[model samples]
Target: MNRIREIFDIGAGFENIIEWLTEEADWLFDFIALVVEGFLEGVNWLFHFPPALVMIGLFSLLAWRVAGKGVALFTLIGFLLILYMGYWSETMDTLSLVFSAVIFGLLIGLPLGIWASRSDSAWKIMRPVLDFMQTLPAFVYLIPAVLLFKLGPVPGVIATLIFSLPPVVRLTNLGIRQVPLEIREACRAFGATPKQMLIKAEIPVALPTIMAGVNQTIMLALSMVVISGMIGAGGLGNVVLKGITQLKIDMGFEGGICIVILAIFLDRVTQAFTTKDKS
Candidate 1:
């Protein structure tokens, strides 16, 4: 055992690599952290700028427009419950983190998905990488994020984005590839360029599948944001963590209920887009 330990200390090797990166790439990491923090603050400001009631009404209106009266009514009731339970601010804080993460995720994922879909080589390269990313323990991501960006929503957003990114990329590639060959041939016969064909034919027909990916990304980001509370990300996650450590069952349960409510609202709204696309 001693000889084996002396021959190979893989954990230490990984730590050394992390330390080297931390020292050598401090400037780049700082710039990224600053950008994430700025975006987070902007989102927080927007969420907090209006009165809670006003924001609730806006969310309900959006739901009605996108999903239907049922979801809208549920949105109104759920948000009111959060407000009544004095969790409005916390809920918004968590929401800002998730929203920021999802935006960043989609920005990066969309391009990768498109590139992979267009090229066999790119798809081959990305497949294993995506598989590794998806299968790695979620907590492992937090370690690097924390070491690079420290505590708070900056690291939270970074971790959430990475954790949630794969689904969108995978689905986008799948969606584009699934576009009918006949449709592509017709577009080509009409002298449609690659870009035009992709935008008009492939993307439009594959929209529902792409939307499903977006929905999954949103769901993953939300779950990660809640977990990020472990590192002081704040919001309902903090509340739930507190309940766990302090044995406040009621508090924890309420926080969990809030999370469920938020998740259902987001899931339904995004899924509605896919439904509309199919229709």
Candidate 2:
């Protein structure tokens, strides 16, 4: 074991980095807790009154416009399933948590994606980080999340965000890279600055791919919603978790169905949004 360890150690200095990372993990956890608290409060504020229904209606309308009848119908079914399963409140809680987490993912992922697009060094640096993030067991994230954020929707959202962010960052970078060099050159020939080119040419062309990333991110986050509930994330997940703990198979199964419906609804809506023709 000693000989094997020495041979692999080389001069990488990984042991030192690992030690430092372990020490810093607590600070990272605290920061995540603070952000999650702020985000949950914001979500609560937005959905505080009847106005939330308005947002829901608008979302439905936008979804209908993009994906047409099929997706809209699916979304309606998802909404009704929540109401039917007696999981409306829990579903709403989960939805709210997911909303906040996805927003956080976008806020952080987009810039990292853009940076990775511009620099190969950034991509190389982020690649291993993303790999580690995804490969780490979901329960591992729950440890710090529970430690810093306590048991509730907030920690759940933080855990979901950490687990789900890599896909969006990677997809966004890939989307930007897929933009044709000729289009970029054409924009430059027209005296477009880097910012203008990115905003006008790159983003518009890359929107579909980025939307695909967002779609994947949302799906992954939703999948974790129920798991997170084990630590205090309310919603259908809580229902399902309760069922499991109490050995009530029906409750767990019903809750799982509700989640599946919600997942389909979200996927259709986001897909419609992404595929819509801007022209």
What is the lDDT of every predicted structure here? 0.93, 0.82
In candidate 2, what are the lDDT values of residues 1-279, reduced to their tens digit? Answer: 988877787444655554555576768756767877887877866654444345457656766888897777667656666666677666667778888889999999999998999999999999999999999888878876676667888889989999989989999999999999999999999999999998999988988899999999999899887789889888777899899999999998988887887788788888777877443
Instruction: Residues 128-212, candidate 1: write the lDDT tens digits.
Output: 9999888888888889888989898899999999999999999999999999899999999999999999888998998999999
Clashes of 2: 1
Q: Per-residue lDDT for 142 in model 2?
A: 82
Task: Candidate 2: give its CA RMSD in angstroms.
Answer: 3.8
Question: Which regions of candidate 2 fall more than 4 Å away from where they truly are?
Answer: 2-32, 51-59
Listing every candidate in turn, what is its Cα RMSD in Å to the true structure after a full C-alpha superposition? 1.3, 3.8
Q: What's the TM-score of each model vs. the native? A: 0.96, 0.86
